[model samples]
Target: CNPIAEGILMAHQVDWLRIQAQIKLCEKGRRTGITFAEALDSVITASSQKSAGGMDCFYIGDTKEKGLEFIGYCAKFSRVMAEAQASGVSEIEEFLFEDQDESGNTRHINAYRIRYASGFKIVALSSNPANIRGLQGKVIIDEAAFHRNVSAVLDAATALLIWGGRIVIISTHNGKSNPFNQMANDIRDERYGDSAEVYKATFDDAVANGLYERVCYMAGEVPTADGKEAWYKKIRNAYGPRKSQMREELDAIPRDGNGVCIPGVWVDEAMRPGREVLRLALDADFVHQALYRREAYVNDWIDRELAPVMAELDPELRHFLGMDYARHRDFSIICPMSVDMSRHRDVPFVMEMHKVPTRQQQQILFYILRGLPRFVGAALDATGSGETLAEDTADEFGHNRIHQVKISRAWYGAWMPKFVQLYEDGAITMPKDDNLHQDVRAIETVEGVPMIVKARSQDLKDPDLYRHGDFAGAGALANFATLEVTSGPVAAKSRRPRQGRRITQGYA
Candidate 1:
């Protein structure tokens, strides 16, 4: 029989998530099938007869899109199980549900609900602590960690238990200090008593328990041990050097305690809002086709798009550029920094282009470089996919003005401190972007070296995160240009700092 066509299927930690419990919490890795299983369980709950032990199910996800996705799962499950047609359960419906605030003021919020013939309804609502207040029945809080007020939501969810309804909390941890993580830990420590049950699942756990096989089946491939292992290795290797991100995101470990390299307070102070930001966006096909013929299009893009943005800059200021060339799920980020008379390091422009063709990268980069004021120097990452870009940049910009940096522990140790020092001393300022803030904060001091934690491979379906530190790397390289200009690049022989004198301690 066809697995997916047969109907709702549970495997590995997914099966664990479906276990009957009055109160259940799932602390899981990314794409570990927890939510998928929750959707199936919800279907069963809403479809089963009341006397046979059925109850209404309410799913509150962290975003409106998540709510819709959860509902999509229900729609699919109902179709596969033939519940809607056979049992007369109504199709997914959009409606308004009444909710109340802490002050007891009533309001109506838009919601999606599916009514099963068993007289039980499964409702999916967007994340809002107040929205859950008047809700009764089994509550499933999906991505609980990312919710605005997890503690408050949990408080509201627990109210249903008084009427013998179940509460299911499902989420991947946001950070070690996140309230949801703390609650999961407390429950596991038995602080919530035996009524609380916590299920833990990691990427490795899913893989070991037939995740690859399921994926193969879904993709219509014959499941084989060798094929599964290959798929596993490919996914894991996609993370590259972001192991800490992997641990926190995929291995279900906390990262807040991993020694954050850039403090939030520092990032907050450096963030400059109300600054004009320049951006250039070209069609994917146009960029590819126009690469070799870039002379015509490139000149036009520079005159129209690039030149105007550069015209906003102070011509007297010495501008520097840093490039982190990347592709295939990673963005290629270019950050431009200026040294003002106040000695403040100002980042006036940050350009991030995704999946840009290689030749087009050179054209855009060259145009931007030629348009800069005083164009002192640029630091281009010379590692992996960046090698060709670095080589081309050196040829165009002159070797003295373009530093092709091969990123390494030594390079990170030497340059990252200077970058941190600029922040600590209030000599630097960056444009306001939440992802940029996250990129800086994602840096953690691992064994005295400050670097970005490479999280395990991210799902292609999910939007990209600064988890890879692309922005941070570009910013650091731009900062490195200033360091190189001032001191002619630190000697490659510079060894790690002496023990007890770690860079992290000075700022902490």
Candidate 2:
């Protein structure tokens, strides 16, 4: 439906707009503070841009494809437009525009010539002014969505357009690179005399309204009723087998396509009844996801690393306690552990994971938890390595006969799994919450591998994490847990420094 030639024509029209009298809305006053006649005077003129040297411009961009294109295309197009504008002007005017010409022309304009003709300025650039600081026009990036990264580039281009009439960008979008596609669509939407107020319309409607493609389909003709299918066949006929590539591009980006994603749980529902126990799983280094909530990419731990606990009013179990006994920044964090008489060998699963960054990281968790919800009891490392930074949160928070005891550092590969599957196949159902059920997937394993996982951190004394759609700690309210499985006395190497006569160590 889109045509590159149309881009060419639209680019040309934009160039023409620069020269149009009506479009010349230069609110900026004369830089020389002199009248036109005085500006021509050699003594009165502050400086002659006619020499075309020592000018300043800046551009900024993100890492997205569309952002990348904006900088590249705009830089390319500006020069191309300059050449097109030069067509009608005489050689005398060209020579007058500069002063160092082999042909004795004053308008030689060589400062940007070789670099511009060679088609790259970033390579030619070195050194830095305070504002540009050698990093001016360089891409600046942040996180966004799959295609939101496209907008970052657009933002950068916008900054470039602003500073030197350039752009700047902030972005995110590792999963779906739709932002750039939208950006390209935005450019196409504004093409062919559309200007700023390009009315929203489909490709057929755009062509019908003489938006861009005018000749091939003739103005006012409707696009094929079959939509993309018809467009594909026609492109195939016109561009031969290579048209498949074009059609794939069209398929890759369905303009105005509906995105189908379930909304994630708000932070509070994540703390309600049965949901709790957050896990941090790693897809890659510097790119981990947390399953602390019922949603994929979700988190609900009030404190960063400490897992939550549920205390029931049972008599025999009241004495047992979940003691996470030790910690530091380098090793696995030591979260506030929980214990009760019932949960030993009773946890449905124990999972090990790495945490990612921000609430935005919840996006990935929503995907996994939306379908799997069988997991229970995730003991966490509350030590601030990847969790929050709170001093003795469990101590200040342990009102329900609970405490944030440090787990004496031991081999994780062996002990954690035993703890993880403590209650596997045991009859444990999370207390019901509408939001939790909706966000967590209810699917059991087909090949005998259960998918749902949960951890605890949801009773009281939490940051607003529980209210913020993180439900990993919801299970802490069910007191049928057993945190004190092997607690005669933990005899592992002291994970913490034993300074002054350390006799009673690991006894939180």
Candidate 3:
């Protein structure tokens, strides 16, 4: 006879216990009662005779509190199933677990256990990679994603399967980049063969299987339609603006990855030819050159190269600029965007500089700003060393026309979506260059925020060169400037003669 009543276990819980795979994993939502179901199964297994497929069960949770909770469930279940057993169950026993490593080193760990008359036992041990290596039994890892070393924990747990022992890994997703999520993906791809399987149980799944009603029953309150709706809404509303965290915890969806955000086709569709990508690379000795020499060199290059491009821009169209800054390693990119009557944003050209000194960077930037027709505004990366340049630019161009942006996760969450929307709506056009293409593709949805990934992409033409989404950042900042900066009456150029020493400009 079954010890559990017909409605005692939810559908997902029953399904979890029903899985007989040697290595089964469950990526589940919070408060789904999977742990409770597992506890009942563990008690049954511990009470069963050796001929009836009974063996020892070891539970490893991420926290000490979780261990106590699991053992409590086992104790309760053992008493409930007393009638089915020929012998009585022992009281909960607290003991030191002797964990041994390959080097014959042993360490004592605090553990709680319950022994059955059938010579089988249920043990709940503290979370530690070394704790699972020497155990020979069914291993259950709870909240595997939150473990200190998820990879190590998984590796040790899988070793149990070699000795005819079963392994169960259960957790809600931490992030897509997390090893637990990777393991789950590997399992779905059949990387683990037929011995392992992955199961998912979301909050909605549990609710549909009478979770809310069960909660009501436990609270000694009558369940109602309005009450259920209110309860569900309350739980969701508690997350506030943390929608990604809510989705990950309640929907079993993993957040963040190195996956491409903008597909190549989308980027390609937005690209147009005939756009210029001016580059300036300076030697190490450029910084030590005399000030006048540096100024003269850059000024000459600007007049020759930048002048022609500036002349081609429509004087009537409003323009904006976005800049991503770097000094030595990565390229500092400047993207100038012109908006036509149709509200279409066009990138006239992109400027890239490598190993260029800060003073020359400012000179080139000032010239570009002064040249852009009807310049509305510009956004500059003000993070780290870029702060000084951005602040100086804001001071020179008037604070109203320049935005010093502090690049961060929160900023990306707010602004990156708008930039992405431009591409999706076909409202923006950019240069058709492979490097720029790769830079834009570097954006990834990290923790549900569309931001550039940490990894850098090698320059297609120059393998020695690398980019950290320089153009993409500038583009996003430029787009932000256009949307956020208010367009005021254009200031007329001063007819007064310039004073003081003139800084020369030339290409590096």
Which has the higher TM-score value, candidate number 1 or candidate number 3? 1
Best by lDDT: 3
lDDT tens readout by residue for model 2, 1-508? 6443454333323332233111011111111111111111211111214243212222222122333333343345444544765421111011111232234433322111112321223211111112222223222221122221234334434433333321212222111224543443454565423222211112233233333334334554555446545653553354233332223222232312212111121112222354344444333333332233223223233122322222222223222222121121111211122334454322222222234343323232222212112212222223333233122322322323222223223322223333323223332333344433332221112122222222122213322222211222223212222342222321233122111222322111
Better of 1 and 2 by TM-score: 1
The TM-score measured for candidate 1 stands at 0.59
Minimum summed lDDT over a 10-residue window in model 2 is located at 22-31
Could you arrange the candidates by TM-score from highest to lowest?
1, 3, 2
Candidate 3 on 47-71: residue-level lDDT in tens? 8888998899999887777999999
Candidate 3 vs. true structure, TM-score: 0.52
**TM-score for all predictions?**
0.59, 0.23, 0.52
Better of 2 and 3 by TM-score: 3
Predicted structure 2: lDDT: 0.27
Candidate 3 C-alpha error for residue 299, in Å = 58
Native-to-model Cα distance after best TM-score fit, residue 356 in candidate 3, in Å: 43
- Scanning candidate 1 in windows of ten residues, the lowest lDDT window is 499-508
